[model samples]
Target: MNIGTAATQTGLPVKTIRYYEEIGLVTPDRRANGYRDFSEACVEQLRLLAQARHLGFSLEECRRLLSLSADEGRASRDVRALAQQNLEAVREKIASLSALEAQLQRLIAQCHGDDAPDCAILDDLMGQRGN
Candidate 1:
C-alpha cells in the first residue's frame, strides 16, 4: 500500500513514516513514480515504533530495542541493562523538575499578580531580592 494507507494502519503521521524510512528505521520499496510503497512488515515496524515512542524511548534507544526485539533468544541481561539506564534517566528528570517546581512556587508566592506597574515577579527575576 501507499504511505497514506500505512499511516492509517499504524496511526502515525506520514512525515514520521518518511523520517523513519530516511533514517533507515524502515526500508519500504519505492515505485517507478518514486512514491513510497509500504509492506505489511514495514507497517508493523512503524506501529512498533509508535508504541515505543509513546513509552518515552529515544530514537536511538528504540533502534537498539528494535534490533533486540528481532532476536527470539535475546539475552534478558541486555534488556535489563537498558531498562536500568532508562530508570536512571527518569529519576534524574523527576529530580530536576521537582527542583524547578519549588523555585517556581517560591517565585509565584512572592509575585504581586495584581495590575501594578511595579511587579514583584519582574523584581524577583531581575535579582532584586532572594539572596
Candidate 2:
C-alpha cells in the first residue's frame, strides 16, 4: 500500500505520518519513483503509534514503547513504569488545572458585569488584587 492507505488505516493525517517518518518513527520503504511504499507491518505500527499518541504518550515515549513491543524478551515491568510515570504527570496537570479553575471562578464571582469601568478580572490579571 501507499502512504494514503496507511494514513487511512492508522487514522493519522498525512502530514503527521510524514513528520513521524522525518523523526525516524516509521520507516516506510521508497519506490524507485520516490513514492513511499507501506507494508502491512508498517501500517500496524502506525496504528500503534496513533493509539499511543491518543493515550497522551509523547513521541519519545512512543518510540520506547515500540521498541519494547518489538522486543520479545522485554520485561513487562519497564512498560508498567513508563505508564505509571505518565499517569503521575497527568494527575499533576489535573491538580494544576483544578486550582486554576478555582481561581478563575473566584475572579469571575468578584467581577460585576455592569457599566462600571473597574473590573476585578482585569485587576487580578494586572496583579492589583484587593484594590
Best by lDDT: 2
User: On residues 1-131, what C-alpha lDDT tens digit does candidate 2 reach at each position?
Assistant: 89998989889999999999999999999999999999998888899999988988889999999898889999999999889888898899899999999998999999999999999999989989863
TM-score of every model versus the real structure: 0.86, 0.95
Model 1 local distance difference test score: 0.86
Off by over 4 Å in 2: none
Prediction 1 TM-score vs. true:
0.86
Error of 2 at 44 (Å): 1.3
Error of 2 at 46 (Å): 1.1
Candidate 2 residue 106 Cα shift, in angstroms, is 0.8
User: What are the lDDT scores of the predictions, listed in order?
Assistant: 0.86, 0.92
In model 1, the clashing pairs are none
Per-residue CA lDDT of model 1 for 1-131, tens digit only, reads: 99999999999999999898889898999999998999887888898899988867789987987788778889988877777787898899999999989988888887778877886767778998763
